[model samples]
Target: MRLQLNSSSHTPLYLQLEAALRERLASGEWRSGQALPPERELAQQLGVSRITLRRALERLEDEGLLIRRQGSGTYVSQRVEQTLTALTGFSQDMAARGLRASSRWLQRGIFRATPEEALAFGLSPTAEVSRLERLRLTEDEPMALELAALPVRYLPDPQAVGDSLYAYLDLHGLRPVRALQRLRAVAALPRVAELLAIRPGDPVLYIERLSYLPDGSVLEFTRSHYRGDRYDFVAELKGGK
Candidate 1:
């Protein structure tokens, strides 16, 4: 549907256009990551000058509702702000924000631990480990690619896991009480970009996490690649006493 600008209102044309576009996003008329019509085409459709439409688009971009790629045009941003202070599962986080969380499994099973996985899990090279690899989704949109490894004793049946690995661990009394995480910015590789629906070389957040059980045993070693455009990691700081 074409968005109509209200000329009779006291509001500025650009502001009116911005509000209408925001409504379209809020109402799901424009889905997350969906490209917007070309500037000229959209301006014509809205019966507004290019300048007015540009101004409105700029406003939305500033507010993190739109992303403007140099050669790819504008797309609706699927921005989800996550707090760094929380030790929560993906499903729990999405539930807090009233978004449905789901997963598309890429790999799941017990396998002999690779050298790196063996070192991470403190297991022998021949020891088996349960691996769960999946694409995390929120509101049916792909959000992150996660690969997690744990000792087979803790996760004996990878197929028993569901939407949330943390939840599954909790039920088995193996959930982590604390975690150490390292996050870095990396360019997406072709395979990751394909699964994430972004172009290769786009920025992505790479995270490595080591979650510990209450007794300080490592419970999980997880590596994740999150779409940079979709996630904002917020950290809170307070002054020392």
Candidate 2:
């Protein structure tokens, strides 16, 4: 096998090894169910410590791309395959792969709208809004905690909402044409930490999104905190030639 390792890059040695192994797997350089090189000797050849090599192996094992056997050694896994696509929702995305999805409705109440909510939904500040909070789960694993606000003037009833808010909007002729979302990393709040079962100072993904209908009316304003460990947001760039 041809091996390439670069130590001068800013990337960590473990990450570099992980990426290299991933590239080899993607390029069919390593066949499925085949054994990879031993850790100690390969570490020496790659000019990385055995700990670094093991960290890379651990990542691959966690990703289900590598299978580690106690006595036999590490081998390429045959059970890792998934088609990734854009415009995928958690429920539909997980269900397509035969994984289950469930949501625990945290709160459904009406309250006086805030100024920000008014601006998002184009409603008067005095307007009341129906609020929805849910802790979304996949295969019983916590994924995200969602807090959504909708103008009661448009959606007067909160019980009318089903599993998916997007589906509910579609049913009410409020199907969103486009959505603008902002993403940032923030320290988890105490409440968020408690709900997500993480430490308060731990990092979490903060996403604020505004969905707009074709009629130019904002359908919903949602801010969600996603578990960083379970999610990897990818963006593809198509360069203009």
Candidate 3:
């Protein structure tokens, strides 16, 4: 599609182009992960100099609406912003944003708990746990890789879980009341890169969470790797008086 800049408008040329590009993205004219035309080609098509085009594109990149890979052209971003203050499951999170959440199951079964797992659950070493591993997706686009473990008593049938583990737990009255989460940045491994459709060594957000029941016992232990480019975690802060 050709984009025409209003030459007589008071807005800067690059800003006009930026707004046009944003409109296209919002209209779904350019879908996520779809590569934009080459810089030269797009500049010529928009009747603007390469410098103006680059400036506009740079703004979009900063806004997380575009991604430019080294040696690869720019592509539309599939980024989503999430607030850190909420205690919600993946499904609920996506739903709040009007996105459909789905999962590609990797593993779901009962297994002997490791020493660390046993300690986390305050259970005996001989105790078993249920493990659920899956690729979390939205609109068929992979978003995160998750591995969750729970005491077998809480999730006796791992297969019983559907799209949302929290929902399943709620149904059984095993939902966690609160959680402690830690997040760090890490390079994506080859396996993770392939699954998330990103390059190896790309930045990823590694998060570990321990969810607690009302009695203060650990109910779930989960580790997840979120696509750094696709996730913007926000936190609201209040200043002290």
Candidate 4:
């Protein structure tokens, strides 16, 4: 990396280093997940002290632009951003990013509703519900594991459901107009980690959604686990007038 730093300028050396490194990152000098040069080598090449280089790298790590592993060198992060303001399906979200979305169906069939599903869909506990479990992928990369349930009245034939559940619901005039969603961070369990190709203890985002139709009937209840390292959820806030 050829970075020019001005020692005579008023800007501190660490900040200057940070800016230069960020520029290189933005310019794609180093691809995502590529390791940075050793700290000592990088400092010598930049003609700056290792302390200054470390400070700059620390800032980048804290900002989620770089990740530092104990035995491994610093590497670019591969995090994708998702805005929380929109209500969209996995297929739509991936399409907006110009990525092909696909799914590997895990399970699909009609089953008796659980107590929680019964309450969410206003159905009796004994009522059958269409359940679908899938591993969702973007550009062939595992992105999320999803489990969704809908009252049998809405989705009677689970086998007919395709990659996008919302699309299927829309075709039947049962698409949800809005939804209530909650998200929390949790460690990945062994099975989930294996499917997502992450370490068992790695953090993952757990999301629960309850979607409702215009007539106020619950459309679907879904639980999803998203790989934390590859996904970042953002929410926009408005200031008081």
Separately for all candidates shown, the number of backbone clashes (residues 3 or more apart, or on different chains) is 0, 0, 0, 0
Candidate ranking under TM-score, highest first, comes to: 3, 1, 4, 2
Q: What is the C-alpha lDDT of each candidate?
A: 0.88, 0.77, 0.90, 0.88
Tally clashing residue pairs in candidate 3: 0
In terms of TM-score, how similar is model 2 to the real structure? 0.65
Rate residue 89 of model 2 by lDDT: 47
TM-score of candidate 4 to 2 decimals: 0.74
Q: Show pairs that collide, candidate 1.
A: none
Cα RMSDs of all predictions? 6.6, 7.2, 5.9, 5.6
Worst 10 contiguous positions by lDDT, candidate 1: 1-10
Q: How many angstroms is residue 149 displaced in model 3 relative to the true structure, after the best TM-score fit?
A: 0.3
lDDT of 4 by residue, 10-120 (tens): 999999999999988889989876889999998988888999999999999867688787897998876667898888899988888776889999999999888989888
Candidate 3 residue lDDT tens string, 107-220: 999998888788888889899999999999987878999999998878889999999999999999988889999999999999999998788888999999999999998999
**Could you tell me which residue pairs clash in candidate 3?**
none
Q: TM-scores of all models?
A: 0.75, 0.65, 0.75, 0.74
Residue 235 shift from truth in candidate 1, angstroms: 1.0
Residues 1-241 of candidate 2: C-alpha lDDT, one tens digit per residue: 4346666879887898888878878798787667878888777776778998899999988665776778889987643222322433456666765767788999988988889888888788788899999998765657789999987865788878777776677677776677788889999999998887667877888988887767878878999998775566766667998
Q: Distance from true position, residue 133, model 3, in Å?
A: 0.3
The pairs that clash in candidate 4 are none
